[model samples]
Target: MTVKQPDLSFTQNPQWIAERETHWGPIEGFLKENNRKEVVEQLKKLFFTGVIDNPEDVREGFAILYYPLQTAEAWDYLFQDVRLNPKCFKEFMNASLMGSYNEKFFLDDEARLRFFDYFHPATYQPVIKSRVPIGREQKIVQIEVDRFEILRDMAAKFSQFLGGSEVPVIYYRLDYFFSFLDEACDVMDVSNNDKDDIQYFANNFLQRYFKIESDLEPKNRGEQKAFLVRFYNHIANNPVHPSIKAIWQKVLDEHD
Candidate 1:
């Protein structure tokens, strides 16, 4: 017996995309300001009792849902008594297929798959036709979620490096390190073990390689710069683990 495939010819509405883009800018600004309480309150109101009249509201709602600083307990509390319209929720999800920023941290692959399936346009086959095949859509979402998980891990590592102090210079180094890792991974096949190794190296490199003490601020700007210079030079001269060495070489090659 031949099985029939679902028709998936309809693309996301361009109007919805425009509306989401417009709403996203202000929402991003609000989150960047780091007004946690205000953001939380606004999200609670929006999620619990607010009306989502269009795709823009859905985008705004998702922005709140995906904010990085929100803890699991906070999300649980916010969603506890919330009542969502199934139709609107489906529309919101279909319009905002990028999912949440912190989705990987908040939900595992299975949970995310469940989310996608729940809000799947396939359910409303007569009303909507997905431009993406359902199987392919799952893969796309998974890949996007994996990227988010990498970013989430990078943020966590940066926080660990911060260790309660606000230092701008360290952030630049953190960005550089992660950028190198991203670039290197793109150029080479990396396993989970390789990723773990890279992260381990990153944590140690900040303290041991750069000689930046966790509890204390750098004593001198010149010394910190000197340390970075020496570390880079050492890596350039050394034969390291293939995975890590590739990252170092990539960074050095870019600088050169």
Candidate 2:
């Protein structure tokens, strides 16, 4: 299946995959060592903290993600590129981050912004200035949710990543999404109207996007009981729009 490609700095650097796998695996270790509070703090430091410490010039291979220190829209796109700050981890790892290989901890701009707003309701968001982590020593970036281009780019990029993937990736994306969105509701204070939009997006992305080139289909009767049992549990653990749960019930009825 030809997944759609949005405008992005898409690269297939085989080296980056090896680099991340060599260092970090899943975030479970990070989660295990740190309590949920500590995990949130570390994530804030990694992805939310953003700064342009080195203002000298663009590093050679990483121009796509170079930090634009000066302000001059006329200067160049290199300087004008206003992405969710990559200064946090990019500077530390010397890598072009993102993709399935990068230990899933890489929060896109949307998630970062969600985190920021949740934590700092009163503080006006800015290009956060992040330094090296005091203990973890991993650099990261910051982002916001108001930007449409970022989310479009993210959905497109994720579509590409997910187009021809396995079951685990689907599970990861869905699980991460519900968890993230569930928290975002609390953090961003999602109203019913806002949730309508979220519901629409979630429906398309989860049902339509994941099936672009994948073979994952609805389950059968033998598993329906197990499915419904967990459905209730998952809803409690990560409450999403009721309509979403309704979709689950719809599927269950159809199968029945």
On lDDT, the leading prediction is 1
Off by over 4 Å in 2: 1-163, 166-178, 186-201, 204-214, 217-233, 243-256
lDDT of each: 0.38, 0.34
Q: Quote the lDDT for 65 in model 2.
A: 26
lDDT of 2: 0.34
Candidate 1 clash total? 0
TM-score of structure candidate 1: 0.26
Tens-digit lDDT string for candidate 1 (151-212): 33443444343343333222333433334333433313443534554445454434433334
- Across residues 1-256, which tens digit of lDDT does each residue of candidate 2 receive? 1112222221124564355344343443554564465443443232222233332322321222221111122112332232223442333222221132333433344432332222222322323333212112223334343322222333344433333332222222344433433433221234333444443443444453223234323432223233224435776566654555564454445445
| 10 residues in a row with least lDDT, candidate 1 | 136-145
